[model samples]
Target: MQSELIHDSDFGRYLEDFKEGMVIRHWPGKTITESDNNLFSLLTMNHHPVHLDQHYASEATHGQVLVVGTLVFSLAVGLTVREISGRAIANLNYSEVLHHSPVFIGDTIYAESQILSVRSSRSKPDRGVIKVKTTVTNQKGEKVLSFLREVLIPKKN
Candidate 1:
């Protein structure tokens, strides 16, 4: 006897589904933690005292250990991946990244994205490029980070 296999998948939006000015708010915001900051800082070899040393950071302007900016960026982007690029061929580039405010441990971060452009690939008929501008904000609605990312999404079969 032979057994059958099944494959079920939920795909991200295709090029035809992206429209200029489309807005998507990612849910289940992530809260920054001391462990998260420390682990990410150490794992990435970003031994910035402000991110790892609480005592050292206390005397700084923020007066507390600041979460690693890249960690915040990575988390914010990851939160949107399922809706933004789950079926992507590849992430092409990240541009115009700006850190508007500092992120601290215990602060919850929420992400939102706007579709900037969607165009067909002149070379690859099965893929298209989708450009989106993303913003990450804290629980208090203060903008912490913003950037643009372009992804190559595969067409739905």
Candidate 2:
């Protein structure tokens, strides 16, 4: 008897399904809250006043607590996981991260990604690398963050 393998349709895309110009918008926007920012800051040991101190922030440029930049980046990456890297073999690189605007508590964030490049591995024929640029935007449609990352995905054989 022979056994067959099953692939879940809702999981990440394979290398063969990717195109250079493909774009994907992630669902279920996340709302940043005071607790979210504070917890993330505390967990990451990023005790920055601007992100945790409302009083101090009131005197700063934004005049409010700014969400930690790393937290925003983490959320963006997490938002894309289901569609982009859910089944990825590995994450290869991340670069060109830019913070375009400040994020504060109560700001809702959404993310979208565009495929930049795809190439099969030279040594490993069953896997390939996909480079994508992901953009994060706020409720007002203002771009808050953007970054480029490369992930290794398996090819559907």
Instruction: Give the top-scoring candidate (lDDT).
Output: 2
Cα lDDT tens digits, model 2, 24-132, are 8788789999999999999999998999989999999999999999999999999889878988999999999999999999999999888889999999999999999
lDDT score of model 2? 0.91
lDDT of 1 by residue, 52-75 (tens): 888999999999999988999999
TM-score of each: 0.91, 0.93
User: Which residue runs of candidate 2 sit more than 4 Å off their true CA positions?
Assistant: 1-9
Candidate 1 backbone collisions, by pair: none
Give the Cα lDDT of each candidate: 0.86, 0.91
* Local distance difference test, candidate 1: 0.86
For model 1 the local lDDT of residue 127 reads 81
- lDDT score for residue 136 of model 1: 94
Q: Report lDDT (Cα) of residue 104, candidate 2.
A: 92
